[model samples]
Target: MQEKLNQFNLLKKKSEKQVAIGLVIIVVATLLFLTMSSVGSEELGQMLGIIVGLIGGIVALVGAAGFSKVKRTFKTEVLSAFFSEVIPGTDYIPDRGLAPVEVYATEFLKRADRFHSEDLLKGKLDDVDFLSSDVRLEERHVQHTKNGTRVYYVPYFVGRVFRFTFNKEFEGYLQVLEAGSPLTNRDFQKVELESIDFNKKFKTYATTELSAFYVLTPDIMEAIFELEKRNPGRIGLSFAGENLYIAINNNKNTFEIKMFRTIDNAMMEGFKNDLMVIKDFIHTLKLNTKIFKRK
Candidate 1:
């Protein structure tokens, strides 16, 4: 682990230096282009500076892009190694992601204008197939001002999503989204359960009240509560067909290393704990156990 950490840091430092130098060149060139790229009369210095400034900036930006590619490769290498060492029976695939169709099919959270997912983890545990990835859903917003038109993306969900195959198949669809949080404003046909505390913590939506009742049994509700108690994050869940989707809204990215943070045993332990969420969810939810089939 220490050797791998050393390798990660070495490449990170190189990539950072490349990006920093490229940015410095671009900044200097921008100053030249604005202050000295042109003159009232055509002069050698004017033409030469304009050529150096504009062209040099573009070339430097291209170099920055190369560094970004290197960074991506570095991330893949470090993460694959780390996951293999820490988590047994799991395969980390950096480029893959949870299918967008499944994510949208959950319907517990609204679709975003833009979506990004990464750090996919795939494995089977207790004979159940499961996969998860870090997901960020953003809404595109445009504002017209005196300065000009400005566009920005607001993240509606920045967290991790997990999908697991269940033992029983159910035709009805039901969703559980967090409720009563000042930060959320999701409205739907609320399904209230027998547990007042569960109703207070989560808002259930379904094709019908009966479907919600069938899927969110007392044990399921208690499991959801326990899941929250252990994880302590805003969570959304959906049960459809033979699959269960769990979206945890923690506003943190997983498996991605920061260029600045000090990587130590404690940090690695925290990472292992985060990865343990997959195991935790399976065990806490009892996903692998047999369920009564709909008659």
Candidate 2:
């Protein structure tokens, strides 16, 4: 990690120098063009302006490319190393396509028309196999304009999605999402539980009321409430078959490396805390408790 940080520092310095040089060239060219416009021919001023623009564009592009390369290297080396430390045997793939993301969205999210996933982490933790990645779900919208119809994607959800194998298989689907107007499928009927506080905090939906009650026991409800209290953002959960999907909607780019910033203990500590939250999910929700079994 320290070695990667040193490399990042060197790359940042090089990038900054290139950007400063580019800015200096642009400033000098602008001044020269102004001076020429006052005393020299308009053609000379135009030529100088064109030359300066080209030079500035090239320099800026080079600087941006250098910074991008450094950022990718830092993420792959430093950030991934940090995650590996937090969760041993974790494999970080910078880009592993969007098939897993699509599966997560279709099976759990059930929202958004476009999806993109990256920075995948696949491994096992405490006998539980899991796949996690930074997922961005966007909804495509079309606007009728004077010129023509324009279609673009608007991001509705951006966060990390975790899919892991549960301890046992169940018969029906269960969803525990934030309390509000329904966002899940209509097939899942809303379930009213005995706890008023739990009802206020979250809304339970499942294919059968008995299934909801069976999974969300008193202890599990308390754990769910505690998890929600720890994380104030939107939490979406789905259980189907032997797999559990959790989508944390925090609008954060997890495990991202900043090129301009120096890697420090505080930053690394923050990464540890974030990863620990995911790690704790396994224990916090008591997912390993095999109460339900397939008949």
Among these predictions, the greatest lDDT belongs to 2
Q: After superposition, how far is residue 182 of candidate 1 from its true place, in Å?
A: 11
TM-score of 2: 0.85
Model 2 stretches astray by more than 4 angstroms: 20-47, 97-108, 180-182, 290-295
Model 1 is weakest, by summed lDDT over 10 consecutive residues, at 180-189
Candidate of highest TM-score: 2
Cα lDDT of model 2 by residue, 1-295, tens digit: 6776676788788987787788888888888788889986777987997799679868977997888787777777777777888799987787663465445543546566987888787888877778777888898999999999999998877887788777765688888888762378656788999999988878888989988888788987888888877875788778777777887788898766564567677778877777777678888877655555443
- The CA lDDT of each predicted structure is 0.75, 0.77
Model 2: residue 89 alpha-carbon error in angstroms: 1.4
In model 2, where is the ten-residue run with the lowest total lDDT?
97-106
Q: After superposition, how far is residue 187 of candidate 2 from its true place, in Å?
A: 1.7
